[model samples]
Target: MYVLAVLSVLHLCCSSPATSQDWPLDCTARKTIPYHSDNGRLFREDDVWNYTTVILREDLGLIVLGTRGVIYALDINNINTKKASVKWDVTDTQQTECTYKGKDQEIDCQNYIRILHTIEDGRIFVCGTNAFNPMCDYMNYTEGQLILQNDQEDGKGKCPFDPFQRFSSVWVEGELYSATSMNFLGSEPVVMRGSPEPIRTEFKTSWLNEPNFVFMDHIPEGANSPTGDDDKVYLFFSETAVEYDFYHKLAVSRVARVCKGDLGGQRTLQRKWTSFVKARLECPVLESQLPYLVQDVFRLCPDDDWNSCIFYAVFTPQMDSSDYSAVCAYSMHDIQQVFTEGKFKTPVTVETSFVKWVMFSGDLPTPRPGACIDAEAREQGIQSSLDLPDKTLQFIRDRPLMDQAVQPISSRPLLVKKGAWFLRIVVAPVAALDGATYPVMFIGTDSGSVLKAVDYPADNAADTFIIEEVQLFQSSNAIKILRLSESTGHLLVGSEVGIVQMPLSSCGRYKSCADCVLARDPYCAWDLTSGQCTAISSAQTQAKRKLIQNLQDGDTSLCPPSEKAKMINTSFVMGSNVKLKCELISNLAEATWYRGDNQLAPSDKHHISRDSLVIPNAGSDDAGMYTCWSTEGIAGHVHRRQEAEFKLTLGTEDPIAPQARSASKGLVGLQVLVVFLSLMLGILVGWNFYKGHFPLPCMQKQRQSSIEDSQADVPGVLEPLHCTEDKTTAPAGNSNNNHTDLANTVPVDGHATEESSI
Candidate 1:
């Protein structure tokens, strides 16, 4: 059983279908829209650092970017031009305050805008790490410029005071729910509600552990819920869990939720969260039994119903030097089940250690301590979360870690990349030829590449394939953010240097039908009417079309049939060089050479390449049918063949001798004289053979006649084994020896005669 399991794993790693990394994707095939300080005029002199955050406002056709000490709004429609941008920078006084805190003036003292949220009434709430002292301001868009609002607010928890600190925030209806360090020294981290009223988690370790936040979003209550069911904000982060007994801190991914309508606890924990609860988010690779650390999460919703939403999280292995990354998906139902049905871990007394932890098995609070206050609870004199009792608030605070971990929808990750660390993920819906909406994932990597892939529902493991891997930046800069613009069909990529906008699909790059089919992209299909590979949406108008696609089975049947071989006959003189041209139409196919039925092996005399065959020093044995076969493997183990055959003939005389004589008169005279001398020489040779002075040339052939008779029925006449022309001429003093040498050089059927003196 162990051997079988090892063999199965080996087969999966070695025999999996090829990914985009195996094929080279042309970067120049797609259009690139770049916006940086070099081209854009809105950038200040020192605004050459990076575009850390990107937010796309589709309705306004704008791309709002956050960088060091500056914020710029770029026109998406005219992103390449300099005049299509507007910028805003922090004041010098704000920079002075940041520098006074002993921060690096060049690096940390600069305003790194980390938060930008779109609030109500076309206004944007912006915040920056103003040299460790975080501050927030409002901006209103006017005639190409963003004017600052006068009301400035404290941005302690909303943005990380240190530029390198990890944080996440989300704005819902005008309030900002954030998870970040609330102090300048970067020690006190908290999850807080920063608007309407200042409510936060307690500063104790039980309430908030040392955490690094990744993402935050709000999930509204269902339409069929009770009257007082409030919307909940979910925060995803990785925190050090204190319940574990290991010497080192164990980092665990967490999913915490808070009710939008929660006021606070009344007495025991006043102005603090009463409904704050968290559960462990488990992302483990089942085959390896290694838990992965959550890096980022994206919420995917098919429609307006938030209940059906699924969270796609990117995770990396918990090794010190790991190269693998995976993408796991969690449904809302599974998350809710773990939070409600799972037990809680509590502290217990132990003599071996100063602190002890164990699973709690006791009665829970009424209506659930972490649950939102419904109409039934309110009717029982519980108006809000503030009315909850001390025992309930203490249980909720002490037991934030669940006994059971929340598992992913699939036992394994949807896709696992071997060499890349995924940083961010975004899904876009693409309409296929079958009229079904398929989700295309655009994942950003830490190596400045964006991988585009499609996940097929029918075959989860085999059908999920990467379509392309695009290098967004020339340098190996990590991709900071990725945002999709459905209106323009472009994906905006943010890196440390600048921002690049690239089209999601580049169907026109694949010029041939086989390439179009082998790509296996859901958005691309070959159009039969226009004879071009085009996007599915553009080809939908065509009356008759063929889509060259099969996600699981790489179907290349849609490619045009290869042309049949046209047989051609050619004759070459002995000791001459010849080249056979095999015109291969498809670049994807492999070309091979064959002589008759057997495959030709590589030799010094015979040369074979992709499209042509060469033979030097033509001989009688080389005068056979030569074939050039073009073959390609598609999908499974199937192979398609295209062939070109040539019938060759070797002769003592040139086949084009008559044409050469007719073209030039000097050539005809020389040929006539040579033929007359050859006849006289033949008569003398026959007289000598009749006289018995010299043995006849046919006499030596009798010894080898038995061996030569077997090849008599062959197509071409066989020549002597040593019938080679010698360029050297003998002197006049040895005329008889020269004549004998010349006679011996003349070849007979399959044998060479010895020289004889007269």
Candidate 2:
């Protein structure tokens, strides 16, 4: 087992800076909006519990939040506007039993509302992990209020017993299609649909083995097909691969489909899906065979054009610990082609050791195994799935996986982030000023920040620009959910504590045309008429105004010339320091100072920082006109723009007077004469010490006593001034002569004090 694991690990390893992904061009949000309370008071952090689920009611202009022990309804335009709320709590008996099972009474024993699905007639099917025993109900919204209809429905199959486990649900025609575990331990993962003759996937490793569902939705295939096909309920999830030969438990991304009109088969697949088929969703990695695991998925299908349906998903590596995440896109046409024409994969036990999964190349049956009851099947006397032959049903039950994998659009990821683990995604198609439709994606990350990017699909090129990243939460809490409001052009983001609503585009944040053009956001452009950066709408694009936008390559030729700061003349005192200021607002530009076309060198005399240039000990040579130039690179092209300029002069304040100059000359002469006199006095003392006098011995004794007394008070800066108190009694001739020589020397410079002891 150890050797096999090592070999499997060596099979594929993600290379740093992989060529399969594009380089992420980073930008930051110019403005951020945070949540506030509606009652004109600061919102308490604990007022709202963990936001587990969200419902985007675009029709009713409301956004509903499912939290612990309560559900809130707020205005879609403003999340701070609380419309209504409904509280639902569990009993003490249920909490006590939950704690007895080794769960925390405060965290796990509380009701964490997880399921919030919009039903018909302004009603929502709500469910929660009610203290380890799931319960569900319905609630209606009318007249700006949410009222509970009932709480009697058992939520075993509809909601997961563990609140933190992964699951997903979608409602179509009053029946909820959910993918979750059925038991408390959550060992059995199933894709169950609500009543009106309910059916679920088979509880087998080949069917829905250890799946973690991220998204589920249905598409009306009957309306689009000319042969009267059944509608499809698609599921996007990740599960342990049952068709691999690897040693480790390899997780593969899957796109599963089931017909909505199907019922259980007669003899085989009893009360289980007869048309269940799943295929691996492939996202090509550079020189690697393994695909990334699906974390979240968003389906964008236009109401006017159903054939233009696309599925955007977030993927992360299955084995690595890095925060490596990617975004991949798929079209509905490719997904349908794979499911309709793909081969079957069947498992074969080899050598009585392990099961090896291989593609089944044998001939298929008439009225294909997993085909919905279409016009061709009806012609073969098959009106419903139950009427199919037992051989056909058995073939599909055993071979539930399709051989051909569903590849992403352009056969690669749209965008990849090395440092961000994307948690949720919402994409909106915005019309650019160039008369083309671009998809703008708002992706949430693990650092409480939201990244906004634009995808330009031109000439079969996958050019993406990360326009901005906005921090929605004050704390470092991961954003759990994201919802886009088309009516109000607002984005609703949810973290652990609160939800905040912000506009999709804040073009006003860009103060200059150059800054706006460098952003490359599809929704923003520079207007020449108003001299302001404004949001570009479809109508504005149709009008064809003087909107300066360069999505393919950032071009600023049409922008008006910027006005550089006027040169201000200033005089600095001699030997004083000066700093010249050059303020700029461009984050992507580098500022440099120049003096008369020669770039200033940063040395001991001149220091250059981010916003200014400092000159220490200014001199006449340093006096000159200086200019600050900003160099910015946009779309692989570099451009220089002048920001500010200044003129400086290094000079004295005023000229000296004639009388003061004369006084300074006199003082210099006096100092010179004092130095000459001190030198003569020292020479005379040396001559006296060389020739000893006769009768001056009596005078020498008196001088020695006087010198000894004065030595105690004299400073020791010139020579040895220390003497023993009994030196007079032992008096040596050398010691007396040394004291007499010191007394003859006179002090100079006058820096020494008379009252000092050595």
Candidate 3:
């Protein structure tokens, strides 16, 4: 039974064929951008190395890249030109001071630039972990050069002191909101709002417990609010939670928000956030119902308000050894609801001994402590969050975490992968055939590949279709960042080695109409006029453009029919091996075999594979008109067409006989008898003519004479027959049909002769 089970599994793996629906679209990069200098001879000292951050400045047509100890500003219009790069390096004095701090010169002494955010004055704010001592500076563009500003500030919470530590920050309205470790040792972590008077969460375990920040974004005012609300900054991170009953701490993904206008509390939480509230983020797998750990989150919105914003997050299994990863999407409305109506978890003393965390059911403060200062609050003579009463602020500080968790848009993930670990995901809207825009997600994996997919609205939810998988980098380096430029129709891929400029759509990669249509990429279409697969936007102007596409229904009618294949005929001897080959044009189409009108199935004597059909012992029963079909679609309503046909003929015996026989012994006996009867008839006719009468005795005497004459000629015929029979006989185990035929014929001849005489 175990052997049979193993054989069954092996058969499935080996015999499973590739079909058009099951085959994944594969693509390659059009161009690659390397971090190392192309013109090393000219600019020996300048090298754009270790690209940790990539920022695109569309207004200036420049791509600013941050690396260790230096910054590079490349021309976005043409990245290959060497003269277009502007390099800015750290000063020698700063490097000397960084080295004197007893940090590793090679690893930690050099600046690991991590922060690159745009400021209000058209300048860029830059920060780096300067040899474990964080520092910040400004970059201004002037006369084709990026000049570093003289003024510098303490990075602290704005940037991580350790180069390898995870941190996230966002700049909104000239202020930077960041989540990072604020110390050189990397033990003190904080989420703070820096610039224009810095204020942060209380430095306590209750606020942040060993949190690893992933992303930060802001939602502008008056977008989804019925009563115009203040702008809000959202931070996404994962941290060890204290609410679980297990002995070990459980890791939980969190969505923390703070009012942009928050000015701290007046008394109880002075100089600290009064509107900081966080909730758990849940993304569970549909099959296992296990929540995945959130690795990265990307907010897809350009407007000031998050009215149409959706956050796409990459999650992996909680187990470190698991290779599964998934992508989940959360809408702004659901996140807002979780923050507004969700209950809070607060420490409460129960029964006899210990204090435990439970849901707070007491009456909340009047102005809603965790809410931003609104116009009504201003009208009530409350100037800022600072003027709010201590009771209202104390409720927010004590109950930072909500009891309810924020759920994703769908119960299951948008896409799930088995072997690849997704590190980043970005979504962009692409125009479809019906003038409708659909969200296309680009997921970056740790193995240097990107998977592009589209989500379409189905019955009551969305269905995901993976468009293509593209390999951007030759090396298997992790894709740390992915940014899409809608205007240029290109994706900016950043890795530890360098930054890559990849076009979002590679329509020309598809060679056939069926492949183009089956890919289901909204950005691409098969242009019949040009006989090529090209970008949809480029083919829109062609008045006679024939596009073969059906994203929803997967219709392939638009594709041209495959050319008719010629028929093939084969002949094989009985008991010999035979193989019939079927050449299929499309690997995506399913191949099947049919003998005449009946379908043929694989059996012990016959084997059917993806490309060929084999018969171990060819017999007369196997002779038939066989046909090969190429089919698509599901069973019962499949679209099938004949691809090739074969006429098979099986011979009864081997064409090359060992020995030859002129005539069989039975034929020789019959010929001799006919000659003897003719002679006897001649003699009987003469006697009848002479005597003028026919006598029965004379006839019998003539017949006896004819039989004796036939018997005399039989020995001559049987002599050669016996010699031929001796040669035909073989070993006892061998099969000899010649001797059996001769033996059966002699008996039949004797019976016929005896009946004739009577």
Candidate 4:
């Protein structure tokens, strides 16, 4: 026992947050459940994996998944129930040619569906790596089956050549807008819209500079726009910084925009975009450290008003063992302010060769550069992009970068998680019982768990609460995509193995009003009619006495007093052991034992284990009414409730020691086995350490990854180290977490994220 206690302390001292995923801390209503196993529906395939591209058609109650050479449509109501499937595989000749180009036949030479999105007219736009010969085709959904189009288009800029490249695309107004590499070697990256001759970014590094795109979405410019601007397509990515000087190349996150109606330049840029502009996205604008890189982005628009939209993104630091992930939000108003009125950054030669980005301070053009041909520009006779002057195009072509960075809404990170790196984010606006809507954030982490957090935008000072966390995937595989369906109240989780449809809430798990109200779950409320905790959405149809909830303040004061706990009688002889058992429903609650009105403390004669109160040598004073109380802190209040009560008397009885109720013999045998196994493991580890088989540190950097040129450092797909797919196909175990970082933390030249535990 002493050795174990010493080892526990030593382990705590040696452990770093960067090296491991600690238990969720400071989170109100923190409860973890295997909700996926008990309630989720999974769809899997034997030979096919990598279900990265998932398109949900809530209207049809179906979810379409794009995998290796095949697309499967599954019923959203039950993911395990397949509705339809279609195959579009790579031919043997294509595979041969891809292998001749020195690509891995099994991993890289096979077709992996990279793009699957709804185009127009209920049709779908699909693109695949197609064995390194990128090709795209349209599919028509008719009568529950996919009809593949005969004519195909060259997917140079529409789809990525490498399956593991960080890629993104969006379909807007019947046109495909994409951000990906244009070559087999992934050297030429472009952000372009598909057309006969697509208008794209310049070939120069000044425009993109080794970018790894994560997300792209179309945001329509509403009538409220002061300039009546054209619709916009925004891109989120991390790229190598051209302006910073550091020991190694620094990577910075950026939010770039392109007008949806932008056409290629008239003369100076020819086929290049004239309205493409990008600005730095500072998650936390701090002079002391570099900003975290964007891993995934989500846009939450509660209503039809475009001004109400908010972009929430997940971020991770470049390198070093900080074991941290951050969440930041940016308003569309702020993003537009930076791109429209902000100063442009131009590349200027500082010395003989070094080039740096500096604010361009020069004469302005007749039509503002990077401004869409909106009502104002149209009234000025700038009818279309083709009619724009060569002078304006030249200015825009030379300076596509912005100087004033777009900081997060509050100029600080909304949440900085220490234990796990958040890989994906999706927000759902849930109407709570309080009549106010709350944006509940579902964050996917590196450990395959989904964290449900609630943010109160009305009150910025109110702390974001992580209400619950649930393991959605059985394996340790990371969650690459998280899609929330408000209509169905489900969160669709996509991993390498398959897809899982998890319900948003399970309120029946909380039996008491205190537990229900203290949960503060926007989806759940205490239904007074049924006299039970239930989901508000499901209970709306039934007649109810009342529905009560307190989201802003998890006020237990509003709840009726907790029911009295029944007392259990137990008699024990003096000098014998006395044990009172208590079961904890919430791990966040603090448990304390009291005898009558006095609190019990651990002494030589008494001890309190996790689930029980033990008296070593029972005395007469120990014979009294013992009650176990649970106190939980929520929304600035301490809510206490009785969990169990027991009364002890001075007489020998059958159920004397509750701990010994089942079988003292079995318990002793299990304890001995555990001690024996622990001793053996310790001896073996010590022997290996003495033999110099390994280092003293629990984990040490095994090898130093060599630096590559800017082009060589293409951040791998879903990059940021472990945030990507694990090298091993099936995980070794379903354990919640493991220690240390990925082998090569940052293999890319422009590292976006560090996968050290976080």
Name the candidate that leads on lDDT.
Answer: 4
Top TM-score model: 4
Against the true structure, what is each candidate's TM-score?
A: 0.72, 0.77, 0.73, 0.80
The alpha-carbon lDDT assigned to residue 473 of candidate 3 equals: 62
Q: What lDDT tens digits, residue by residue, belong to model 3 across residues 664-686?
A: 55568889999999999999896
> Per-model C-alpha lDDT, please?
0.71, 0.78, 0.72, 0.79
RMSD (Å) per prediction:
19.0, 13.6, 21.2, 27.4
**Is 3 or 4 the stronger prediction by lDDT?**
4
lDDT of 2 by residue, 130-165 (tens): 987888889888898998887668888889888788
lDDT by residue for model 4 (317-391), tens: 675444567778999889989987899888888777888778888877978898888888889888878889988
Deviation of model 4 at 344, angstroms: 2.4
Clashing residue pairs for model 3? 19-588, 20-588
| C-alpha lDDT of residue 61 in model 3 | 83
Which prediction has more favorable lDDT, 1 or 3?
3
Q: Model 4, residue 661: displacement in angstroms?
A: 12
Q: Quote the lDDT for 304 in model 4.
A: 65
Off by over 4 Å in 4: 1-29, 222-226, 285-288, 457-460, 569-581, 601-623, 648-758
